[model samples]
Target chain A: MPILEVKNLNVSFKTIDGVVQAVNNVSFNVEHGEVLGIVGESGSGKSQSVLAIMGLLASNATVTGSIKFLGQELVGVNTKALNKVRGNKLSIIFQDPMTSLNPYLTIKSQMTEVLMLHKGMSKHDAVIESIRMLDFVGIPEAKERIGLYPHEFSGGMRQRVMIAMALLCRPELLIADEPTTALDVTVQAQILKILRDLQTEFKMSIILITHDMGVVANACDRVNVMYAGQLMESGSLDNIFYEPQHPYTQALLASIPSLEHEVERLATIPGEPPNLLALPDGCVFQGRCHKVHQECKGGDVVVQDFGAGRFMKCNLMQNLTNGINQGITSNVVVN
Target chain B: MEKLLEIKDLKVYFELKRSLLGKKRIVYAVDNVSFDVYKGETLGIVGESGCGKSTLARSLVGLNDITDGNVVFLGKDNLAKADSKRWHALRQEIQFIFQDPVASLNPRMTVAEIIAEPLNVYYPKMKDEEVLAKVLDMMHLVGLSDNQINRYPQEFSGGQCQRIGIARALVLNPKLIICDESVSALDVSIKAQIINLLKDLQKKLSLTVIFISHDLSVVKHICDRVLVMYLGNIMELATKEVIYKNHHHPYTQALLAAVPSANPKVEKHKHVKPLEGELPSPLHPPQGCVFSTRCPLADDGCKSARPELRYMDDGALVACFKA
Candidate 1:
């Protein structure tokens, strides 16, 4: 079994404007010590899906389906029960360290408190462990800097503190949501290198959620593309980049401004991300998909397993597969 | 092409007054930057936060007061010394697109009014119908449909709002447009759209642009000439090809190597010389080269004497003693 599995997960919120289906029937699994990337644009429900699995959604949200961690279901679990699993066996590092970190608390207090609460370590032991973790994350003078408040540290240093705190329990799974989005590229590269090193050293699985394809290519082992609350395609990093089958994934890959490849014009998807409150009846990406066909608008799009842990929820892929199997030759290729 | 704007020894310093007994400090936001922007060309200014790229761009439009410098636009050094009326006229000739489209625009104004405000200000004697026609034309040009002219900024998505910002900036038919992180807040697809739109408009209107961004790939995509800034100083200035492929300064090379490329082969296989440490405080920068603190090739010579911008063998201007 995988370390973490999310099956047919759906997250919706009750608002004054009516029900907003933020995440719909999205499913993916992370193996032991694997790095999984959830790539999406804004309002694509990538963040919300992971937030639902952690039970960190707001009170108005309604989450269903299965979010299993080590074969244990997380959905419908009480907050008290979920809290025990959250900071112990699993932890999350958010995008903005300044906002996620408590400004009123010192770095030592915040780092030690997690250990004291989750591991039941003594105050002295927790403080020592906090310093060790900080040192491991390459923060110089961790012993003295532990007393400093979050505001005293730079953006990169604060992110290091957050990472150290997240790894205090050595959780089996770590959810890093856009950890380096607010940082400069040089700092982002440093942080990503630290994360990669820590992932290997601790042998922990990571769920990296980001909007940048460059980040996904740099850090992730497996990648899944999300569009308008649905998973369009997912596969190994190599397959996702070099052999993307879904039209949305292909378009997203082509749209990224690459340093190595200079194209005169980027391949842009014509329409904006769909409004979740009024999503279309069929595939979520149908409105913007360039290869969208009649079948995409008529039925529920189902995930087709393409073997070797690859899957796609695109009608064009299915049609192409069928056409190839039936010996119908065409100049058009899906990728 | 003729030089559209020439900046010589530009410096913008902020006076930070502490308590009554505490000493006053001067933050050199932009320090001794000199460059020439050619007519109808896009010049990219790239750097990390607090690196003075934005300050340099803002100084050109008179948004930030220059401590000491010469800003000559169209053979006139009056942008800084201009009075209210003259500055107003200059504002009509130069416009800006901010990073945050939602915050940059007034919340109360509709799209039409926001685009028409520039027309009304510059051409006060023009009829309302003429202003409306120009606003509609700009909106259409930026890809906003006719229906969106009445909508407020809050109703549009980030991409659409940026389009509205572009429309407003272009409504005046400005000669030079300063885009300060214009597409940084947007998604990749939307960012591409905005970039393409800017390039299209630049060609159509023959506009000189000063584009400021931290994303090097975006800068590489849109800019004709790129300037790499560090600690309020121009580390290197070169064409996009030279900067991307043949960077000389250690700071510029480190910055180029630091950008995570979308290609997995390059990102995974290539050896990245990661830059060490964050930017030092501009209040008390290093005595010598501002980047010597984090530069990998820094020696005692680099730590003792600063380098001046000079032409290198690669046809790029670099400011590094080692280079």
Candidate 2:
């Protein structure tokens, strides 16, 4: 069985005005020890979908879905049982380090709290284990800095501290939300190296949420494209990069000013994302899509299996057009 | 090309009380940094956090008063006293686009109100109908619709909100616009959209833009000339071709390395070797070369003596001992 299976996940946020459908019938899976990347623009709801699966959605958000984690339904799991699965089985590393970390508490206090709560370790053992976790994420002289507050460390180092705190319970699955967004490139490389190495050693599945194609290409095995809270496309990394089926995904790839790309002008997706509250009758990408058709108004994800477990979703009437674009633009766009 | 804006050894300092006896503590935010913005060109000022990119920007725009040296805008020097009329004129000509859209724009105000605020202040005598018409034209230019005009800042997404910010800056038709990490807060796809919009606006308006950002890739995408700063000093300034292709300063190269390659072949490969240590605090900077503490190429000479930015070309300038 897959490590985690999310089936037809539908999520909505209850604001004062009305229910905003954030995630609409999205489904994906992560195999054991696999790194799945969910890439999209801002307000894509990639973060919300995964947060729903982890049973960590915000207080007002209403979720309707079947999330199976190691064969257990996570949607309706009790708070007590969910708490057991949260820190030990599944964990999250949020984007902003400054807000995520407590300014007054030391790394030792934070890491040890998770250890004692989830792993049920003694104070003495927790201290030792916390230092080990710190060292693993590359906080140099973990013994000395463990007592330092979040404000004492640099931004990159503080993120490492956050990672150390998350991994204290030896989670089976890690949900890293824009883990490298605020970091510089070299520091990003260091973080990715650390996460990849630790994932192999611990044999944990990972779902990285980011809007950066570079990050997705570097880290993930599978890529899921989300837009306006809908899964526009899902496929292997090779399929997503080499032959993007969806118009939105193709436009996203075109917009990146890459080293491989030689162009007079980049093609930006023409319009803004549809507001989650006022979605159109057609596909979510229809407004910005170049090859949008009447068939796309039906909201059917035309999926084609390219064998070997790879899948693609495109407009049924416009597959050949995107294919021709793939061949023509691929040469100029890819190095 | 005639330089539109020139900074001659600009130094901005803040003095604070340190002890009971009122000892002074000086924060050298922009220490002897100098550069020029030319006609219809984009100059990128890049540095990591606390390296004083925004400080230099504030100093140039006359928001933060300068402590030393002159910032020559057009033909006049503003370091000394300039009349209120000239100050107001400078305000109209030189504009700033802030980093965070959510923070920069007023949440309570609609997009039309936010964009019109500056126009009302700067063009007090202008007709109200004309201003609203121009606002709609600008909205169309930045890819926003007329329906979004009445919507509040919170109603739009980050990208849409930033478009409103850009439209506000462009409503005045300024010659020089200071974008201080404008795209840094956006996603890559959205970043490209904003960048493309800015580029389009720049060309159409013949804008002389000073784009400040730490990301080299973003600078590479938009700028004509790039100035690499470290610890409040100009380490290097060259054309994008020369800087990205063959950067001379160790700090500039190191900064370039820190931007993760969008390509697959090269991961986070250090360009000039790993910068040895963190950036020294601006409050108490190191002696001589500011980057010596974190420079792999530092020598004994680097620790003891400072290097001035000598002209490599008439255009390119580098301030490294080894360079």
Candidate 3:
């Protein structure tokens, strides 16, 4: 069974301008102990979709469709129950660790509170677990550092503290949102390594959300390409990086500046993402897609199973499916 | 070599008076920095935060009064002999494109008025129609439509606001542009678009650009030459090819190693040896290499004497004793 399953999830927010459909019929699942990456731009609704699954959306958010945690419904869960779900079964690590932690609380108190509450451990037991979690996440001098406040640690160290605090309750699934975006490159590597090491040590699933393709390429097992509040594509890392089928994914991959690339010039997607309130009637990426066609418009999304559980959410697949049905080889032009 | 701007022996010091001792401490914001901006090429000045890259850019535009050294522009001594009257006339030749467009642009001014500010100051008696036409033409060139000519800076996204900033800078037909972290605030895809636009405009207008940023990947994409700065001193300056291929400086090598490799199957050095010591206090640097305090290769000679920038193996200049 999948660790987390989300199906037909749509989230909308009531704003002054209009109701913005921030997430549109998003469906995906994470297997036990799998690392799933969600990549998208600033307004792509990748964060909110997961936020909804965690029951963390604000008062103005209107959520639809189903989100299940091990076959348990989560759409209309109560706050008290959701709090139980958090820190014990599910946990989140934000990009900025400073804000996630309380300033007044010492590191020991902040980390132990979750364990004391969820695991029902004694105060002394919680204290031992807090320091152990710190050491597990590679914090130096855990005893001395555990007594220090969150402000005492450096940026990278503080992020490690946040990860330790999140994992202290031994959550089955951890959601990390751009956890390394604020860090320098070398620090980013260290943090990604620690995350990888801990994911294996703790044996938990992770939902990694970030705009950086490079970070996801290094850490993710499977990838979901989100664009304009919808899933543009989903596949393995090799499939997304080496053979991206979606036009948006293609543009994103092509834009990575690497030493291997000869052409100094980059191929950029021409237009900004469609506004959530004013999304196009066709494919979400059709406006910026170079190979957009007339038949790519206004339909319930067409999904073609590529076998072995791989699927493509593209209009070109419709024609390819028909051609294959006629026993003819199907080839689609791609740049 | 026909260089556009040649900075030599540039040193900037901030005098801070202590309250207890009443003693002055000189903060070496920029010290002994020298380089040149060549004609019709992009020179990327890259470094980590607090490396004095921004200070160097502001110093180039005369926004910051230099404590010492020269910012010779087009063969003229910018320090000793650049008369105030000439700065006014030459102001049109050197323009600044800021990183945050929303903050850089005046929100009260319309797009036309913003673009025309340069012309209004430079050409006082020009016809209003001609100024409007120029503003509209610039707007069109930067991909803005005539319909949004009356919009303010706050009405557009960060990318659009940046385009307006570019348009405003280009209104005076400046030969050189100082892009101080221009694309740093933008997204990845937007950054690519802006880089492409800048490259296109650079070629079409035959403009010279000094692009200052800490992002090495972006700098690699946009620059013909790259200069790595540390604590207000040039650690490495070489062509993009040499900087990436035959990298000489130890600091430059460390910086290149810092970028995360996109491939996962290959175990790229997971254990990063980040610069060991904290950035040495810019105030009262050691008598030798600025990096010597953190350098594992620092020797007794390095502590006693400073090394001058000399030609290394690949025609690049380095200051370390080992080099």
Which candidate has the highest TM-score of all? 1
Query: Number of clashes in every candidate structure?
Result: 0, 0, 0
Residues A1-335, model 2: lDDT tens digits: 89899998999999988789999888888899999999887778999998898788899988887999999899977899999899788999999999998888888888898889888899999999999999999888999999999999987898899888888888889999999888866577678877878888899999999988878777788899998888887877767786776677777887887643345466676667887888887677777667768887765657665555555565543333323433334322221
- Model 1's TM-score against the true structure: 0.97
Model 1 lDDT per residue over A102-158, tens place = 999999988899999998999999999999999999899999999999999999999
Best by lDDT: 1
- Considering just the first chain, candidate 3 attains a TM-score of 0.93
Off by over 4 Å in 3: A121-128, A135-142, A147-152, A318-335, B14-27, B79-90, B263-307
Cα shift from native, residue A9, model 2 (Å) = 1.7
Error of 2 at B299 (Å): 3.1
Q: Indicate the residue-level lDDT of B189 in model 1.
A: 75
In the range B71-171, model 1's lDDT, one tens digit per residue, is 88888855656666777888878899999988988989999999999888778999988988898899889998898878888998999999999999988
Ranking by lDDT: 1, 3, 2
- In the order shown, the candidates' DockQ scores are 0.81, 0.43, 0.46
Interface RMSD of each: 0.9, 2.8, 2.3
Q: What local lDDT does model 3 show for residue B150?
A: 89
